[model samples]
Target: MSEAVAPRAAIIRRLSITRFRGIGNLIWRPGSGVNLILGGGDVGKTTVLDAIGLILSPVNPSTLSDTDYFGRDIESGFEIEAVIALPVDSAISAQVRPAWPWAWDGKDAVVPALDGDSGEPVYRLKVRGTEDLELIYEVLQPDGSTGNLPVMLRRSIGLVRLSGDDRNDRDLRLVQGSALDRLLSDKGLRSRLASELAEAEVKDALGDAAKKALADLDNTFSERSLPVGLDLSITGGQGASIASLVGLTADRNGIPLPLASWGAGTRRLAALAIAEQRQGDRPVTIVDEVERGLEPYRQHALVEKLQDSGAQVFVTTHSPDAIAAASKASLWYVDYTGQIGPLDTNKVARHRANDPNAFLARVTIVAEGLTEVGFASILLRRALGAPLSQFGVHISNGGGHEYTLELLEALNSGGLSFGGFADDENGKHPTRWKALEDVLGPLLFRWPKGCLEENVFGATPEGKLEALMADTLGDRTGMRRQTLALRLGLDAKTFPELATAAGDRLRPTMLDAALGTVPAGREEDKGAYKSHGGTWFKSLSGGRELAGKVFTLGLWPSLKPQLLPFCNSVRSAVGLPSIEDLPQ
Candidate 1:
C-alpha cells in the first residue's frame, strides 16, 4: 500500500459577522497566509478577530452578554459565521463524519455526495447569541441540515489567541483549555502526577512536632467514623486541584519559579512557543498589537516568523516597524464605518517600504518631499486647531516629484482616501502631472509657476522682499549684504549699487540665485539651487522655519489663496473644520 499522506491544517476561508459589537455587518475573505489588520482606533479591527475566535473557539460554554450585541440591541441578536476549509481526512468533514457535507468553489457552495466532486471541502461554523444571554454554536451543512458542533471537533480546529492586555501568562499554564494542557492531553499524565503527589512521604521531611500535628488530624478523622484518615499531602480543597496547580516552571540558580515570574514580553513569547508545538494541530494564531511588549527588532522577527509558520495568522498593529515587517501579507484596512477591505500590496509597496505610517491613517496627504510635508503640516495645524493625528490625517513624504505622482497613482488605483501636494516644476513632466490633476481634481495642490523657493519670493511685493531678506538673514552680526551678494556670484564690486536699487529690485536676482542662475565657485555651487548648494528652505527643518517666519512676517495672507483650499480638502476628508470655518 502507498504511504498514507498526512492531513493539512484547517483554515478559515471566509468570515461573516452581523450585529456584533461595533460592527453592524462585515464579510472578510482573508488570505491563507498572514492578514495584517490596520485602521484608526475603535474601527472594529479587534471585533473582526474576536468574531473569528468566538465562532471556532474550542472552549465549551462561551460567554455571552447583552453588551456583546451591536449598539447593545439584543433584539437583533449577534451572529458570527465562518466557512472553514478542512484538512483531508478531517473528522468533521463528510468523508469522516458523513452528516455535514459542504463544498465551496471559492465563491459558490454545494452539497456533493462524493468528496472528489467537491471543489473545496468546507465546513460552516456559526455562533449566535440570544436575547437572554445564551449562546448557540452549530455547524451548517450544505444540504440545509444543522447539527451542534462537538467540542472535540472544535478543539481539532485549535484557534490560539494572544490578545492585547493579556499579560497574565494564562496560556502558559496547565488550565483546562490552555496550550500546555492541549499539548499534554490524552496522556493520563495529570492523573499519574496527582497520584504520586498524594503519596509523597512528608513525615520523613517534617519534624516530630509536625508529625504529631498530622497524627492528631488522623485520630480526629478516625473518631468521626470516617474510614479514610487525613495525612500530610498537597492541598486540593477550596477549588484548588492538582491540574490547576501543575504548570511549567523554569529553574534559576537552585530555585524553580513559575513562567509568570518572567517579564511580560518573555512570558508571551514563551507561551506562543509552546502553542506552536501543539501536537497534530496547526493552529490559526491571532495576535492583537503584536508589538505590545516587543522591541522593534523583535516585532519584525515576530511577524516574519508567524508568516513562515504555514498556518493562517491574523495580527493587528499600530507600529510602523510591524507594518513594514509584514512585507508579505494581506493588508486589510478598516474605516470608521466598520467597512473592511484589502489594501493591494502592489499599490502600497512603495509606502510600505518608505512611509508605512500612512497605512494606519483614515486619509493621507502624499507630499512631494520633506519641504511639502513640513509646509503642509504647519498650515494644517493652524487651520485645524490641532495636530493632524487628532483628525486621523497623515502626511506621507513622497521623496520627490516623480515619486509623489507615482504614489498618488497607486493610492488612486487602490481606492484609498488621499490628497496630493507637489510643485509644478515650472510645468515639467506636464503630461503625467496633468493626468494626476484630472484624477485628483480638487484634492491636488501644486504651485502655479515655479518651485517652493521661486513661488514665495516671486509673489512677494517690492520692498517686502527686501524686508523678508533681512529677516531671513537673522542676527548674524558681521554678515553684510555685500558678502551675501558675493556668495551668490553677483558682482562683488557693485554690491552698494545693487543694495540701493529701486523697488524690490533685488528680489528677482535673489530668486535667480536660489534657482541657480548665477553660479561659479565650487564652494558656492555645493550649496546651490534646488536641494543642493543654493536653495533656501530645502530641508524639512529649513522649510518649517521658513513657514514659521512667513507667518511671523504676516506673509501668510499672501500665500493663503493658493494653499488654503488644499488644507481645507485634507481637513474635510478627516472630518475637521475647514480653514474658512475656523475663528479668524
Candidate 2:
C-alpha cells in the first residue's frame, strides 16, 4: 500500500516595509531559493529577517518593550507596516498596530479605529480605565460595511495569543509540546491511529494501518531501551545501559565502557543525533554559526543533514568551506550599505571550476552589443587571423550605459578583458567614450572615425576580398553594402525599395570613406564631382577631384597585383584601364 503524504506548506512570498527601525522605508523582494542576508555586523540584516518573522507571526507584547522597535521607551511607540502570505485555507491577511496600555475595558472589548470610507478595521489594542486587558474584534465586510465579527476570526485570535511568545526558548518549547510531541511521542502515535480509525472518511484503512506500523518501527529504532542490570557508559562519562544496545560493551571489571572508548568521531555523531531528536517539526529553524564546534568533515555532514530535512534554514558564517557546501547562488557577501544583494556567482563558479593561482586568471570578457561584437569579432579575426571566441567574448545589449559600465567594472575587477563598441548616434560624444575607456582601460578599442562609413562589404580582408566578387557576380551579392549606402544618403533608393529592385545587390562596402577611401572615376567625371566647398565628393580631398585621389593614394599599393584584373575589366566597361595587363 502507498504511504500517507504530508500537506505542502506555503512560503512567505513578499515583504513590505514602511517606517521600520533603522531601515529607510523600503520593500525588498527576496528570492525563492535559500536567501542569504549578508551585510556588515550592524547593517540591519538580522533586523530585516526578524521583521519578516514578526509580520507572519502574531505580535508579541515583548516587542513593544524592545528598544529597537520603539525609538526609546515602550511608551514612545512607533508604527510598523508589513504583509504576509497565508495558507489559502486560513482566511486572514497579516496586519498590526500599536495599542495604548489604558484603552481596554474589563468585560467589553473596544473596537480599534476604522477607516470611515473603506470601513477596514485598523489594528489597535488598549487597556481600559480599570487596567483590564481588552481583546478588540473588528469585522470589515466585502460590502464596505462594518459588520459583526466572525466566530472563526475571534477563535483564531485566541489561538494566536495562546501560541505566540516573546522568547525563542519558549517558542521552541511550544512547538515541541504541540506538533512535535504528537508526531514523535509513543502515546501521541496511538492517539493519531485512534483518530484515523474514528474518522470513517479516511478510506484507505490498510494504508493508514501501515503508516502507524511504520511509525512504530521508527520509534523502536529511534530510542534506546536498556535491559535491566546491564549499565552502559556513554561517551563524556554519562553512564547509561542503552549504549550497549548500540554495540558499546563493559570492561572485564563490569564497569560500563565508554562509546568514545571506540572513537571520538563516533561520540560526536552520537551528540548530534541527540540534538536532532530534540528539535522536532518547527516551521522555521535558525542555525547561527552552524559550522562551530565541529571538525571540517563533520561540519559538511551536518550541513547535508540540515539541508535534507526540508526546513527553512538560515545560516551565518565566515568559513569558505561553509560557502562551498552551499550553492553559488546561495552565497551572499555582506556589504557595508546593509542592502543584501547577489554575489558575483560567475566569478565564484569560475574559481571553483578552474583552480587558478592568480586572480587575473579569472577574468571575463563583456561586450556592448551583439552587433558591435559581431563586427568586432570579424575585424579582429581578419586583423589577427585567430578565432575571437578563444578570448571568451560576451555581449551585453546596451539597454542603458550604466548597466554596460557595471558589467565592465565587475569583469575588470576580476582581471578580465572588457571592451566593445558604443553607437555614435549622439554625435560621437567624448564623455561616453571616456567613461567606457576609463572602466575598460587598455582593453578598450573603437573605430578611429567614430562610425563605420555607409558602404561596408565585410568584417575581414577575406570577406572584403569576397566583396569584390560583386563586380563579377553583379550587385546581387552585396545587400548589406547597398542598404548602408541608402541609409547614409549615398544611394538614391531607400533600403527596402532598393532591396526590392536590386534583390541581393545591397552588399556592404569594405572601404570606409571616413578612412580616406575615395571612389574611382574618370578625370572629367571627377572634375564634375569635385567639391566647391561643403559638397558631395568635393569635401573629401579638400576640393580635389575624387578620381585623382583614388588613383594617387586611396587604393593600397599592396593590392596592385590583385586589383589589376578587376581594374582592367571595370576600366574597359567605363573607359579607363582595359581588360589587359595594365599595372602588372
Best by lDDT: 1
**Candidate 2 per-residue lDDT over residues 1-584, each given as its tens digit:** 12112212223333444434565444544443445443234445556655544443332322233444324333333333322222323334432321211111221223323432222122221111111222222333323343333333322221111111112222122132222232244444434544454555333434767657756666665565623222122222233212112333336477776443534444434433433454332243344444455577776775676566544444554345655566622544333233444445664454433321111111123334433434333333332334533332223333333455554455344333334444444444567667667755434544433332222222223324332323231233354344245334465444454434443443432232222333454344443223211122212222122222222332324333433443332222222334333221
Which residue segments of model 1 deviate by more than 4 Å?
1-7, 65-67, 94-118, 187-242, 320-327, 332-351, 360-363, 389-393, 424-459, 470-534, 553-579, 582-584
Relative to the true structure, candidate 1 has a C-alpha RMSD (angstroms) of 6.4
In order of appearance, the predictions have TM-scores of 0.76, 0.34
**Candidate 1 lDDT over residue span 1-584, tens digit each:** 12222337777878899999988888888888899998777778889888887876767654577779998999889999888887776667543456564666665345654535446667788899998788888888777877887766777778778888745666777766677878878557667767888789766799999888888888887889876565566655545457767778998887899888877777778878898887666788888888888899999888998988888999999999998889888888875456777787886787787777887877777888887788778777777788778888788898888878877776665344467888887688888878777766657889887777777776566656545454353452123344346544455444445556522546665655444454444455444332331235555654665566567667767787887887777766666666563233
- Residue 105, model 2, lDDT: 24
lDDT values for all models: 0.73, 0.36
